[model samples]
Target: MSICSYLWCLIISLSCVAPLSGNPAAVKEQISLKREKTITNIVNGVPTIDKKFFARINMPYRDKVCGGVVIDRWWVLTAARCVDHVSDHQYELRNVFIEIGNFTTGSQQKKTYKAKAIVIHPMYNLTTNSHDIALIKLVKRAPMFRVAELCSEPVEYGTEVGACGLGSTPARHPSPSASLHEIFLRGIFFSFASFFEIDFCPDDQVCTEPITDGASICNLDEGSPLYKLQCHSRAAECILGIASHFVASEHSEINCSGGSNFASVPHPYEWISETIVFDFLFNSGHLDRSF
Candidate 1:
């Protein structure tokens, strides 16, 4: 279906739902009514038909949610800032859970795994938003889900890519969508992203603009996978980057109007590989720790 038609259908479908007004009673009723149905619009995007490699990083204690990609049987990749609370002692690995193999955020059938460890890039700078990627170690292997392969080369400018996430549509709903949504974006040069107010786009980041009108990344989309299909097969998608942040001038704004930035997967491929391998060998007692 076309983007416009899809959006129209979403509007018609939600027209009957209770409006989330300032009335506490109305808000409570709306919440109660939709507790079992979280599926909503995706800022003009469409619902994803398949979500094999998609993952959701849930921090229930902090009431935070971020998107993730399953990279290995026991590892997932996401934005470092999503789990940065760990550095400040606000939360721990025990509080982080990775949910996979589900399209809806409210689905009770998805597989959940505890985070055994989280490795944030040593060079990650919260202030500058540089090196924003991180690796999460799952306590149990997630072999039932497909693992997304990191792109070996940088995505070319003007290349079309897909971004999937369970984020909010500020215009439609303030809450994250119950269902997964996918949007198509075209990569553009950092020079073209002048509206983002960034003096220069770092090499470690990939910049993309929405291909469809009104489509954009929203709140809770952080760390979501931005991928490209391999051989045009939806099932064979490769990870190109993870949703980093919106670099708009208004840093406080959650609506991504200018464009979105992603931490390039290829830029940190070496670190990711080394971290996974070293962690495996060290845990298996195959590597000597006393150097």
Candidate 2:
């Protein structure tokens, strides 16, 4: 793929942080504070390949909090924390909606369905961030838009992976309704585990960075799925990784947003396939699961 380079504007900071305590764990030696988890106020650089595919995500919060994938006719997969921000009842799954086949700004796509129920990853914990994932249930079966295909084989070192999202561009993020959109950004990473590590799992979570296409996903890029592209394969080239958190914040005195640091997703996505997430979909009846 050709790399598109864009100069990044200064990243505005998000001001919340989770305080960590020096505690001991059953299997750890030295304990450091884990990342305090939170969601961004807006999404930037949101993009989609097909409006129909795009139509499968783009949800409505109290006012469009974020985006996700409609894996099953009944399930929309998104970050567990993203759902939590707009929900008061951690135990209840109701009053959430999503739109697909549409862009953040202008559009042309199809309709999927409204969310009737929502479910977070059973293992996800806001405190430790054990599992940072979730599933949303649509009240009805969303029309079958093509779902992303996860790789059955492991990703090779230096294997090509692609990322797309309704996330913030380096210039604009957490944009309001007027600036909100779904734009696609090709992600390139600075390192790789599959190529670099000998004991890495070949599952879904293989990490890499842009070598030339230097644009990366920002705070709003949570739960954005990374894909590998090939000219021959019709299905997903492979699952690269989810848009997780920035590592620089852990060592730097600042955050990712430029405040002391920036926001990031904790775990990389290795098994967050639409099918894996679809199992938790509350009302999945209309969609096919032959995948």
Best model number under TM-score: 1
Expressed as tens digits, the lDDT of each residue in 120-229 for candidate 2 is 55555555434555666666676665454444443333343445565554434333333233332222222332232322122223333332322444555565555555
RMSD of 1: 13.0
lDDT at residue 271 of model 1 (Cα atoms) = 84
User: Poorest 10 consecutive residues of model 1 by lDDT?
Assistant: 32-41
User: Candidate 1 at residue 86, lDDT?
Assistant: 65
Task: Give the runs in model 1 whose Cα sits over 4 Å from its true position.
Answer: 1-42, 87-91, 105-107, 169-172, 189-198, 231-236, 248-254, 284-291
Query: How much is the lDDT of residue 128 in candidate 2?
Result: 40
Worst 10 residues of 2 by lDDT: 9-18
Instruction: Give the Å error, residue 272, model 2.
Output: 6.8
Cα lDDT tens digits for candidate 1, 85-199: 7642324777899988868656676888988777888888877678899888888999745687888676545567788888764434657778888887766434333333334
